[model samples]
Target: MDVAINYLEENFAERKIKIQAQEYLHRFYGSLGFKQVSEPYLDDGILHIDMLREK
Candidate 1:
């Protein structure tokens, strides 16, 4: 994940990145600069939430 994010930041010129992550893993992503952007929701029966990283 770190590698992919670094690749985007270095090469893609992206404004922001968004992901639907498992709710319990939010903290893991938060360490990578992602912040929760949505309330908990279910996806394919798994609890998940939206997160985003802005450039």
Candidate 2:
């Protein structure tokens, strides 16, 4: 996941990355610099939130 984001940011010149992170893993991703962009919501029976990281 880290390598993928890196490629998008470096090779693809992506300024923003968006993800629908599962609630439980939100903290893990947050530690990697993702920030919540939306309140938690249900998706496919799991809680999720919109997250984004800006490069």
Candidate 3:
């Protein structure tokens, strides 16, 4: 996952977009520079968090 993200980051330099993932998936995206945005919240009965990587 990290390798793929690195490739995307390197390849998508002009997108100026943000990538987000839930808390459970935090570690995967974190390795690629994404940061936790806030505490977990209940969404559809599951705990969710927002992590984002800015372009």
The lDDT of each candidate is 0.93, 0.92, 0.67
Ranking by lDDT: 1, 2, 3
Q: Candidate 2's residue-wise lDDT over 1-55, tens digit each?
A: 8998998988989999999999899989898889999999999999999999987
Off by over 4 Å in 1: none
lDDT of 3 by residue, 18-53 (tens): 544566887877776777887888788777777766
Clashing pairs in 1: none
Query: Which of the predicted structures, 2 or 3, would earn the higher lDDT when compared with the native?
Result: 2
**Could you tell me the lDDT of residue 48 within candidate 2?**
97
What TM-score quantifies how close candidate 3 is to the native fold? 0.56
Measured by lDDT, the strongest candidate is 1
TM-score of each: 0.90, 0.91, 0.56
Write candidate 1's Cα lDDT for 19-43 as tens digits: 9999999999999889999999999
lDDT of 3: 0.67
Residue 48 shift from truth in candidate 3, angstroms: 0.8
Model 2 misses residue 14 by how many Å? 0.4
The TM-score measured for candidate 1 stands at 0.90
RMSD of 1: 0.9
Error of 3 at 35 (Å): 0.2
Which number leads on TM-score? 2
Instruction: Summing lDDT over every window of 10 consecutive residues in candidate 2, give the lowest-scoring window.
Output: 24-33
